[model samples]
Target: MIVRRCVGLLALPLLLGCCVVHAAPPRGFDVLHYSVALVPDIAAKRVQGQQTVRFKAEQALSTLTLDAGTLEVTSVTQHGRALAFAQAGQQLHITLATPLQRGASAELQIRYHGAPAFGLTFAPEREEVYTLFSTSQWMPSVDAPDERATLDLAVTLPPALLAAGTGRALPTRTLADGRIEHRWRLDTPMPGYVYGFAAGRYQQATQQHGPVQLRYLSVERSPAQLRTVFARTGDMLDFFAERAGLPYRGDYQQALVASTIGQEMAGLSLMSEAYGQDVLDDADQIALMAHEAAHHWWGNRVTCAGWEHFWLNEGMANFMTAAYLQQAQGEAAYQAQVDGWRTRLDALRAKGADHALVYADWDAPTADDRAVVYRKGAYVLHLLRGELGDAVFWRGLRAYTVANDGRSVVTADFQRAMETAAGHSLQPFFDEWVYTAGTAAQ
Candidate 1:
């Protein structure tokens, strides 16, 4: 997500910058996969969907719950039989007909429909529909970054509209009602938040790199204009792959939508059309470009274990964006980005709003708080690079990504990787910058 930072004061302190205050994670079962079928009535701003949750129990269980946000679950079933269930506030409780023994697997089908108040967009005037964030708000599923699941999605929308989503596209089917069922299958497990789709009357183009397909979709940009704005995507992907030591996996899509905002999903990104125009007018408008594209490797793949260590996601992406800028643009562009981050922290510190990079809570985070995660997080990486030199730093990053690829990570895991690569302790550096709120040491 691309949010502009502002000035404000918020005082918070943490122990070693690693305490996170979220609800206790659901135990006893891990969601294995989600098979969903959805139909959206764009003109009415309403949608209905059937969601099937497959899970494996780690302990004996009679019931399970999912974070269901304002969705009216019509029924719950196992196999072909109806099961008892309840919808309380933001949770969906399903009672297993037979006690699910330890290690047993089960599937619960959730049929639902509602006009989502958020996380989904229905642009009738613009003739487009897309999802923004909080996957639970639109679909019933676990919304934890640590718990990942595969997805098989089938969306029924107007025949005239074009659509794109996570994973690879399957053959489309037209129903008797004349609506088309566009399907996608994501074999790799991913956090639910990044699983989404966008459909509209778009002018699009494709670029192929190896087995991965690169797609560009826009509501307004001509095919030539789309190329002009996002011309460097291939280079950016190549740069990230070389530095992280992990080839960018899966197909990638960039869709410029009707609003003025930027966000990313597992294999797709929704960028504002306004920003696309800005890029056409200015060549240096690459920060947002690099930032969002970097998420494929940083935030989405090598994920943070908890929100407290969120800097591992955004900070890494931000810093990698700077690195990409240095390679593609110049040394001055990279220094300018670092200096800009420093300036934000300086201003934030002047207001007494700065805190340790990791905090206990993110409930209603202020702009000053984001500066710590997005800027200071990136700043420390820049400092770490300076301390370890290019060889050790890049090696550490590769070691970390290769070891923890497709796994949740904490700051300690990162420090351990760097220490192993450096053949010494990095405790003092982390304590000063990451665990304590102070100026970045030269």
Candidate 2:
């Protein structure tokens, strides 16, 4: 069996007292970065875009950085006036002719055009491509999970293509020669990855779940197949609300793009077409959808303190989604699925890479580290739930969400909240799952 190694938690104990590691908490809502346009042509295998970012340095600093990837600048301007800038690798360096003090807002107008390979992940076997904005491309910001902010995007696309994104579309504008522009605004603050767009000829179907309206869009040819695949979205949402004690938020929507990636954002999710057709069907589909949907609470609302604790997001969402599926599908299926994942974890452990789960080692993570973060993280939550009991576990999760909404948190924060809900301390569990190098027996 092939297994992947985990990182982050395993290195914690060794580094104790060597250096203090703490992610900064949100001071206040500070910046408004507008992604004005994205234009991609698949046939050419390239993408180009521009951004109009407006930001305020809450405090004066000698050094500041924004998360940006490998991109080329065509032009730069400040407040409608031209400015000169330099680049050092992926960092875009701009100097103010005069020092700008704190509490000062500025508009940066940058025109960039590049082939953002990060946005387009291709799967050769399936002949599909997944597109999403990873900070490794054109734009820059504090490219960390702790820096959750709002985004307003207007995407321009060829007339033949349709797009699905996290925000609501205001209207579509037509350019002179037939290209179209779609304006979307996300009022709520979200992590950057959540606000992604996929453009293709797609079909959409809508349904209402209690107080929330839901929609599922997919490539047009597979409308019937998609309907069959995502049939349980409503039921899964209802199950999650009752079991997890948190309702699905915003305009709940999901779409299967012409790619092989699936992620949950605040109100919308993108699933790759192959994933939708292959792995997403029947009970498995419910489990995957529930996994993404629960992120509406775990990942979207209360984000991780930083990418280092991504397991905090992935683990909780995985466990909660499994919990919902258990309620809806029954214990045997849940246990079976858990065992299936446990097998994956065991393989990783045997390969000696299980230590990645407990170490904050994401500097240059390999594919193995990614698997550990997702699957092993889920196992950690499962162990925690076993110790806390069902009522305490669910109540603790609900309370955690209530206390930390619109904020990011770390292992200590989660433990404190859960301990309060359980009416007892959970230091042992945190230590074993988050700071130790080995997995607790499943």
Candidate 3:
């Protein structure tokens, strides 16, 4: 996820800390898939839903816990039988009808309804958008970055509206009530945060790029402006694929929404509506496009184990955008992008707000914490690339993505890949840039 400006600090009262480490799922189960059925009432600003989760028990467990926000859960059941459940704060705990023994697979279904306070937006005037970390606001799941699961989502809404979500779209069915139900299937496992949907009156255009299909959705009748903004998408897909030594995994869909924040999901990306209008001339928006696209390989495919190593996601995306600019535009354009990040970092240091890239204080990170994590994190990658040289650096990156595809990783994972490719220890480089605070050495 990338934002143009810092919003208010994140305060998640239910979780012990706002960081990923504290919010990790229990080790007893591995979620395999989720089937979510949602009926959203735009005028009422509420959603009613049912979710069935399939998982394999890694250890003997009598109870299961999932992260669900303030939604009102009506019932919990297993195999058509009612099961005892408890909801406290953001956690929903359910006792198994029979203990799930080690290596056994099981399924649980939950029914819930609520007007979500976050993660989902109801805009009867424009479009309904779901932001990152908002998945738990509407659906119950193990809401952590490390836990990945495939999804099947069915959304019921007014017949006039269209629903765009993760993965490929299935045939639309009209219910007897005259509402339309759209189903989407995401067979590739992804972190819970990336599962989302947007429903509203929309105009969609399709473009084919080799085996990957690109779908662009917008509220405007003519999405020519959006098409212009994403004109280079095919070239980017080719560039990142060649650079990372990985082919595009799934079909890509992008939506222009009502917010300024941009997010990259499993096979979908969302950009603020402004990007197609007033922000069209902003070069940063172009870079933002490339950044979000690169996340398919960085953040979506190979995720960060925890927020402490968030740079493994955002930093690589940032650097990869610059690398693409260098090839597509010129070296000057790439240097300008790097310089912009350095300027942001220098300003943070002027205020004595500099922090390490690993960010030890995971509970609460101020605005400066965000800046360092993004800007400084990109700078660290820039330095690493220079030290390792282009040939070795690119090779290591490709190796990293190839080896860790579909898995959660840490900073050490990246460091080890680079060292293996460069045939030398990167300990000193990591120590100064990632482990230590303040600016990179001149």
Candidate 4:
């Protein structure tokens, strides 16, 4: 949810030039040259990676940093020649022996190792490994939601392990000890947090429909549950295609992972193994699946331009999931979810903690703030749709998806698309829901 910023009415010049202009970070790697080797042990919760980032510097720089976390750099090399490198905490500082010129491209290769520490608040003595919340724990780049770039990666894993990530898996060769070298080529640009890696003993089931391929990766012992999980995937794809005006693209697959969380990567979604096998008769679990399915369009396709636009991702998912349930299970089921969300929203607002649906920073919000963002954000879209009517609303959604496909999007962009579709401006509504805090006027 939006963190308030005090701004003067006459500060338009500075706001236009500096504040909004520097919304996202400057990517260190260019389109042409960069490579990574990310190796991980899922059972051990340990990761090691080697990165070779090549970019042209526009001016002489005293320091260059890559977003890293708790990494121990083993070696640094520049163009096959050795170079001195230093690291301070999460920032890897490279002190070039000489100044790099404005027109020169430089290659810096770094080898680093660390087990990600995210949901791990205890000592190693208390627990063997850390359970990480974000994917950035495995490797380093500018680890932010809005930070996006294409990556070429080669991963090595045990022979028995099954690996699924955002990228297309390249051919692998068996190592002498029976381990495998799994190479992946990520042609699409992806957010740092959306990149993923999950490995375990798995059974991969594949189905083909003409040129489109549907795959499900689950652990070795869950064939019975796979029947139900994979059964809904094809139908979900068809539903999204009809609503979003396109089919899911590029190496479509899903992973039934070991953890109790499901995350969407570019082409893959990691579903918790527990959820896969456990009993979930509730609509919430089904809604979660639908929510992740919506991510292919909302989160993966038209990404948030910054953390401030996080509502673009969660709000869309929440709305789409309810829509999916309505289509599949009829209006009653959909209205139930909507009513529940509204009740939650009301409770959050009553606490005097209603936050703007879009947040300006990447930090996790407090529980009350999270409730407001997730619930209120969805309600805002519902209200907008009601105002615009079904035909115009759906048309605006299709236009929005098509116009901003595979790119970062902000609030103004969506508002403009909706305005065009409705044949009138919806600026006041957006301003109340997205720019200001507290309850939107009824």
Specify the highest-lDDT model's number.
1
Evaluated at residue 148, the lDDT of candidate 2 is 61
Candidate 3 residue-wise lDDT, 325-392, digit = tens: 99988999899978988888888777788766775454455678777777788888998889989999
lDDT of 2 by residue, 1-442 (tens): 0112111222333343122144443332255565557665565655567777766767663233444566777776776777667767576666544455678766777777666656454333322334454643635544556666677766666686566666776688999989988777887777665666655666777776778787777764355666677777788777766654666666777777655446676577776666676644433656667778777777878887766667777777777777777877789867876786688788877877775344566656666686677777887778878888878887887777777887877766777778997898776666666666555456
Badly placed stretches (over 4 Å) of model 4 are: 1-22, 25-34, 41-44, 56-62, 96-105, 119-133, 278-284, 438-442
Q: Give the Cα-based TM-score of candidate 1 against the true structure.
A: 0.94
- TM-score: model 3 vs. ground truth: 0.92
Q: Report the Cα lDDT for candidate 4.
A: 0.66
Model 4 vs. true fold: TM: 0.86
What's each prediction's TM-score? 0.94, 0.87, 0.92, 0.86
For 395-429, candidate 1 gives per-residue lDDT tens digits of 99999998988988878889899999999998778
lDDT of 1: 0.84
lDDT of candidate 4 at residue 81, scale 0 to 100: 72
- The CA lDDT at 16 in model 3 is 20
The runs of at least 3 residues in candidate 2 whose Cα sits more than 4 Å from the true structure, single-residue gaps closed, are: 1-21, 24-30, 61-64, 121-130, 136-138, 243-245, 279-284, 356-358
What is the Cα root-mean-square deviation between model 1 and the actual structure?
3.4
Clashes of 4: 1
